[model samples]
Target: MKNLKPMLLEVNANPSMRIEHEKELSPGVFENVPSPVDEEVKVAVIRDTLRLVDPHKQKKKDRLDHDVSTAPEAGLPSLCLKQVFPKYAKQFNYLRLVDRVAALFIRFLGVKGTTKLGPTGFRTFIRNCKLSNSNFSMASVDILYIDITRRWNSVGIDHKESGMCWQAFVEAFFFLAQKKYKSLPLPEQVASLIDFCEYHLAVLDEKRLVCGRGIVERRNALVTCQTDGLQLTPAAHTPLLNRMATASKLADYRNHQY
Candidate 1:
């Protein structure tokens, strides 16, 4: 595991608009990282294509016509682990979870000769996990709490969060300050969250620039709320998604869901 100390020290000492320097490595390659799995690992990679396709529908598979459209086009596949532990999938939305897990897997397990998961060795790891191909480009996704703790612990943080999203980062930042740094007060902890994201912009992966866009939007929204007399409390900070799912049940409210 890589220590974030050097990266942190460098950025803090000499902050600049110029981009930070990074190694020129190929995609999915990390230096000196080890495979996340071991003999003790109970989760196993599955390679059954039948799980994703209807074998009886051979005619459909043979068709080459792009004009033939279908409602609900074929969705991304699923990981064997989901099948083995159906209970886990029931608790969380697997579609989103798989993206983050796949990113971690690529970072740590892209070595040669590792057990393959699909068609090509890499594809096996991917399709078996049902990862979005776009995950290769994602800066970060909402990660599982366990994954966050595991990664943070590996890098020497005795205490950690479930994931490193803005919410988690904000809490951790204030936690370091003993919850007394109250220069900027709002509906909740909006300013503190933005502050953490601002600092993190320099340290996040270069490819994560896209992810930075969302953080910028959220930070601006918080600033606007502060300027306009809108409260920024934890309770008030509920995302539009929650509002859509709860308060807005009628068809007219659907447009606000975005």
Candidate 2:
């Protein structure tokens, strides 16, 4: 059995139905008898077969999609900034900016296979970017990076293997830009900083530019809050009802003939 290859013979779709067999009684008289033992055996076989097919069915909690509260760190499909940041989506061309930034990021880090960026590579990329007419100075950029790092650490983000996905990168960019220009509104500040970065990136050499490596041009699925707008019943109401029943002196009353 171990040396031979197993071949699939047939598949029974409805295997749990009870089967009846004809039992000959006297000369030609026949009676149909249902076999409960055969039915039970069939059910056991089906259950054991399913268990063998899916061995990880009991460990579903360890899967990636089990916890929807946290964001994915690595191996994420290409994402658009609009889906991740819908509030500022209509204000600026985040799609284009994300692509441009991703191209530059790939070139700087020489990234291959995956679009994830580590902390050290991200810091190097930020330092290399020359922002013109922007409020962010060298010192301010370092401070912003530190703040974002602390935020990632607080959320228990693992930067050792997969540093930051495309979504995280765009989120960090918006956070840093928003912090630097607090007086301006969200749309204005983000747009202004994007313009400055775009002008600088536009003049760089196009020979080493790599497109669609880590980031793509499409919007990924959004993660929505499952518990939003839920109204839970108050426990105080239950206590109030119990108190009313006790006040009426009906707590020990019993009707046996009803």
Candidate 3:
């Protein structure tokens, strides 16, 4: 019998998105030095879609028609609100813009492959959440996190909130930031957890000379609450979402759950 060891899983953190800088490759593509994912645009698109269906209907397969009726009518197949919204629909045209010039500071520590949660090495990275704290595994999701992290840092978003920042984002949502090439903040980390959907999961739109359409301007300012008087604002109202989870919740979710 061939002594068989388990095979490692490979995750494509930096999937090839061929948009580059200065040197134009095609007629339509622009030369973006830095890229950031347009979180607002993503939110706008998703909000439009959710008008009809629950965006998080994971169990339901894509078979039924949830028509929104906005075309020639007769020939049009069943649709969701995603089809109706124009700005959101046009968003795909700017996939290249996801990596803005401001998104270059991120440092991606490459790992071999997606580490199995069962392994002892993943103790910290896979601790309370899906991964252990110290576990250094390379999954596709890490790429998204790297992108988003650098992008957010550029635009002045140090979000340390509950829903938008912690539970829905953090480790679970880091994959979106790991693309390494282009990154941006996402609108809805999970479906129901998000209330307002100005955009789905996109970076800012910096084309056509348009700046700050859907996003709330987040300057690099942290509201300092002294030793006592720190009034907390809700995450829904702010553009910051890069916060760590509550201590007890994090501890319970990671170290104590077992």
Candidate 4:
């Protein structure tokens, strides 16, 4: 059985004429689609892109700057934005921060009684946020790999529960994302977070942490498990930590030979 598409047509010809026309129209599969060629044409017209290699493409705009295939109608050129601006992207620390913030918001949604956030709820909330990009660089705010291991972002730990909420929230994110498929339409909160991070540099970075309640109160207790986790030092930091031993050996060899 084929369902007829109800058309809201303006009738100047008269009600009887409209009814007669409706009756004449066949109620079948062919009438429903109306155009197979249009659908096929659309499927075939999928965008094809060329990958140009240029380290300094952003310095100057050229004739090929605008992707003409996509748009000749609009005058503005399609800006050659890099997918992962490795030079400008931040480190895992920034991701950790984002994960934490996601956690805090997710928690509020799943709280049972007093609106307190939990790990699972925060995780679900993040699932709903629908972060579009698979690559993390789109979310960073610093000079890419500044080694968050340094003692730079530790200030202002007393203002709000932001750090704590973030910590738990991040856990939930990883939990759900490991082996699950979230629904289609992503939630506005996720998009909002991504948009906010993409535009505002300081809010995500500790150096320029947003100086307000909305930004500050969105925190969580800095869980001990989360600490030193994103530090990409080594499978074991201890073996690498013993660099002095190798240096001393070289020094001993030089001394003995002399």
Q: Of the candidates shown, which would achieve the greatest lDDT relative to the real structure?
A: 2
Cα displacement (Å) at residue 173, model 3: 2.8
Each model's TM-score, in the order given? 0.15, 0.34, 0.15, 0.17
Alpha-carbon local distance difference test for all models? 0.40, 0.57, 0.34, 0.40
Candidate 4 local lDDT, residue 239: 75
For candidate 2, what is the lDDT? 0.57
lDDT (C-alpha) at residue 69 in model 2: 38
Model 1 Cα lDDT, one tens digit per residue, 1-258: 134232222224443322233443789754543334421122222223344343324357456563434523354333332232444565554334334334434443345444212123333322333332363312222232334434545665433322233333323334422333456554234344334433443344554776788899999999998876655465566686687767656655777675
Better candidate by TM-score, 1 or 4: 4
List the candidate 3 regions with Cα displacement exceeding 4 Å.
Answer: 1-127, 131-141, 157-258
Per-residue C-alpha lDDT of model 3 across residues 1-258, encoded as one tens digit per residue: 024443333246663443334546599775665333434333433444564565334344542354424323335333323343345756653342223211211111113332112112222222222331233445433543445444544554544421112222333333423322133344322222121111221222233224543232332133233312344455443444433445556777887667
Q: How high is the lDDT of residue 97 in model 3? A: 27
Error of 1 at 186 (Å): 22
The positional error of residue 246 in candidate 3, measured at the CA in angstroms, is 73
Candidate 1 error regions (>4 Å)? 1-54, 58-95, 108-258
RMSD of each: 29.6, 31.5, 29.4, 23.8
Better model by TM-score: candidate 2 vs candidate 3: 2
* Distance from true location, Cα of 191 in model 1, Å: 20
TM accuracy, model 4: 0.17
Q: Across residues 1-258, which tens digit of lDDT does each residue of candidate 2 receive? A: 123544443378765355577789889999989777766555555544554455334356567566543444234322211123455556655555666556655765555666566656666666555641266565665665556656655576555544565555667768756775779987667666667665655655342354433233222212122223132345537788888888666534643323
